[model samples]
Target: MSLETVLILISIGIAAGILSGLFGVGGGIIIVPSLLGVYAFTHFNSPYIVHIAIATSLFTIIFTSLSSAHKHFGHGNVEWKAALYIGLSSAVTVFLFSKIAILLPGEILKQTFSVVLIIVALKMLFDKKGKHEDPAEKKPEVFKPWLCLVIGALSGAIAAFSGLGGGVFVIPLMHYLMKVPFKKAVGTSSAAILITAAAGVISYFINSPAGANSIPYSFGMVDTLSAVPIIAASIPFARVGVYINRKTHHYLLTKLFAVFIIIVSLKLIFF
Candidate 1:
């Protein structure tokens, strides 16, 4: 890697970190697309190296989520019980699906990745942000443990394959199904991403092919050089973002974020 490339990666890291903190996402929203552009431009194909980028993004999220989760947890907003149940279920699914992902052709995987990101961005755009706070009207409990598990499992599988932290659906699921306040659900979901991201990283290690050339300095699929800066930058900026999030409505933030995702996605698709 040239010094110019390292500098570019650093700039990407700072931007990703700021966004991750603001949205409670893994910053793969930024990382994966940026990586795809760079890789395609540079023509670095060490067999399934895109998998390495996804894996590396997950590792960075481990720390980013930890810091953000702790902040939300301290606010008494994180639903540990729900997060744990979902994490366990999703981790298993991620492990299974990741094996399949490794076996697919590389170009197909990129297109699949692009499609998934498009779906996520569109979902964010259309997601109804109902009044976050619930009234005293007696609403029946809607989510059972098994249902939560199912949701988590799907989240895990998708996150592993697409380099997402699964915040897109998790927030809506908890709010609509369990009557969790939007803020609380968002906090808890951020915490859950920590586990889901870790699970994805582990699965990649188990599934990564031997003698794959894209992994220059990696154990399993994580590219440490790419991940280290993301973690370092995301942790502090995310803390600031969390603090800002406390004051601003996350719904508005989500809407703005969706627009950015769409713009970036279009740029990548066309470029």
Candidate 2:
């Protein structure tokens, strides 16, 4: 890769990492598209490269989220019961869907994943417009096994296709569905992302074409070589994002972020 490509990847990593930490997201939305942006700029034409990028980003999240989760769990904020419920239910779905994801052409998967990001982000933004996590909201009912499994399954499917941890969905579910406190929901979601992302990545590796190149860290695959710097730099920035999240008026920022995601998704789908 050229110097320009390297720099672009580094930028994507740091930026995505910060976003991941601040919002407790998986960073796939940013990483996958940023890989496309890298490909567009570098003139690479490998079909599965974007897939690799998404996979690699998910792999990276395994570490990033673990670290973040551990730290947040330090505050006794993580909710083990809820996270386990979400992870268990979704495990089967993530496995099945990741296999399906491997079968589709990489380009289509890339575009579809982008669209998923757009839709989820829009939901998040709109949700934020109202009370995001009102303590006054109703409490979760008796934890039904089926309901938990269904939600977990949905999260897995989303992660399998889009490389997100499903934390975006998970947090809201905790808030609106389970009546979890906002901070606890965020902590639980971060932990949940680790489990769900790990399961999805394993499925991706298993279902992809044989050989090193099919998964992350291979030549054109997940491009871990390119994604590493981003992961490293994100450590500092993620903390910053978390701090900023507590202080800033997130309404405008969330809307702006959502608009950007929509524009980028449109470009990838059409351009």
Candidate 3:
């Protein structure tokens, strides 16, 4: 890869890591689109470019999520039981959906990703600010197993298809449906992303098409060469994002990000 490409990958990684930590997402929102842009800029055309980008994003998310989750756990934000239940359930669907994902055409995959981005952006744009509740007044976390299973299944499908690591859905579902606090939801979602992304990466690796090895710097569907620098940069920045998440409110920033996502989605859909 050229130095320019490597620099772009690093920058994408930094942004993705911070977003992953801040929002409990797997960072695919940034990673996948940015990778597609990188490929386009370099005139690297491939029928599996979308798959490569998604798979690589998932691979990087494994490390990013781990870093973010560990920090959140230290901050007492992670709900381990909830994360376990959701993550384990999601893994099943993630594996199953990945098998299907690999069969789809690159254009279809890109379009699907665009639609998912719009949905996530809308969720972010309309989401109400979470209020701080008194300890005594806060409801105990009481997520039902069945509901968690349902949420996990849905999230996993989204993760596998969109390479989002499921946190976009997981965070909102846990916060609204299970009544989890926003911070706790974000932390738990990060933990769950670790499982979902791992499942996705495994499936993408095993199910990769013939000649996948011919792709430069790739292992199966994953672009390992790209993933390495991204993961390395993301790990430390994930901790930085965690710190920011804890120290400040960013309602305006979230809204702006949502707008950015919408614009990106529009470009993907129309341009």
Candidate 4:
């Protein structure tokens, strides 16, 4: 890789790690686009560049989510039972759909990813239930196993298709449908992502296209060497993000991020 590309990946990692910790995502939101950007500038010629980007993002998420989840667990933010239920259920779909993802055209995949991001961004922007409410005033909702399973299944499909770690959907589902607190939802999503992304990366690794081994510093479709720098930077910063998540109200940050997602979606669609 060029020095310029390495520097950009490091920058992407820092941003991704913080966002993962703050929002319980797997950092794929930043990683995917940034990887695409890097490939564009570096003239990395390959028909499977999109697949490589997605696979690499999933691979990196394993560590990012691990770091973020550990910190959230330390803060008593994780709902372990819910996370396990959702994650285990999601793993099935993640594996199945990821295999399917490799068969689809790259343009189709990009379009699907963009649409999902727009929908998720809109939902985040308009949801006002927790904006001003005191956490102490709310009663925790009962955990429903069936609902979690459904949510997990849906999230896993999204993760496989978009490489977004399923957290974009998982967080909203748990928080809105299950009435989980925002912080707990984020924590739970991070834990769930660990499972979902693991399933995804495995599928991508084993299902890589023909001649994929010729790609430098890659294992199957995943660019492990590219992922190394991102993972290394993301781990420590994920803790920093978790600390920020705990220390302040995130209402404004959430709105800003929602806008950011919309912008990213548009870029994917038109660029």
Candidate 2 lDDT tens digits, 1-271: 6777777877776776666656666677677777777767766665566567667777777766776676667667577877788887677788888777776644576577567767856775686433453442345534566666766877787777767676656765665566665556666777788888888777777777755374334642355676667677666665565555455444554554456557656755675
Name the best candidate (by lDDT).
4
Predicted structure 3: lDDT:
0.82
Ranking 1 against 2 by TM-score, winner: 1
> Which is the better candidate, 1 or 2, if ranked by lDDT?
1
Ranking by lDDT: 4, 3, 1, 2
Off by over 4 Å in 3: 105-137, 250-271
Q: Under the 3 Å rule for N, CA and C atoms, how many clashes does model 4 have?
A: 0
lDDT of 4 by residue, 1-271 (tens): 8787788888888998998998888988789888888888987768878888988999999999999999999998899999998998889988888888888854676678679879888987986755776342287766999999988897788778778888777876776678787788889999999999998989888888797555687888898778988998999999998998887675665676578678767765776
Clash number for every model?
0, 5, 0, 0
Report the lDDT of model 3 for residue 80.
Answer: 88
Q: In model 1, how large is the Cα lDDT of residue 25?
A: 66
Candidates in order: C-alpha RMSD to true structure: 3.8, 4.2, 3.3, 2.5
TM-score to native of every candidate shown: 0.81, 0.77, 0.86, 0.89
lDDT of 3 by residue, 1-271 (tens): 8899999999998998998888888898789889999989988888888888988999999999999999999999898888988998899998998888878643565468678768978987887653344221267776799988887887788778778887766875776578787678889999999999998999898899897656676888998888888998999999998998887654554565567667656765664
Q: Compared with the true structure, what per-residue lDDT tens digits does model 1 show for residues 74-178?
A: 877688888898878878877787777777633454455456656766775787744462421235536579977977887786677677787655765676678
Residue-level error in angstroms, candidate 2, position 142: 5.8
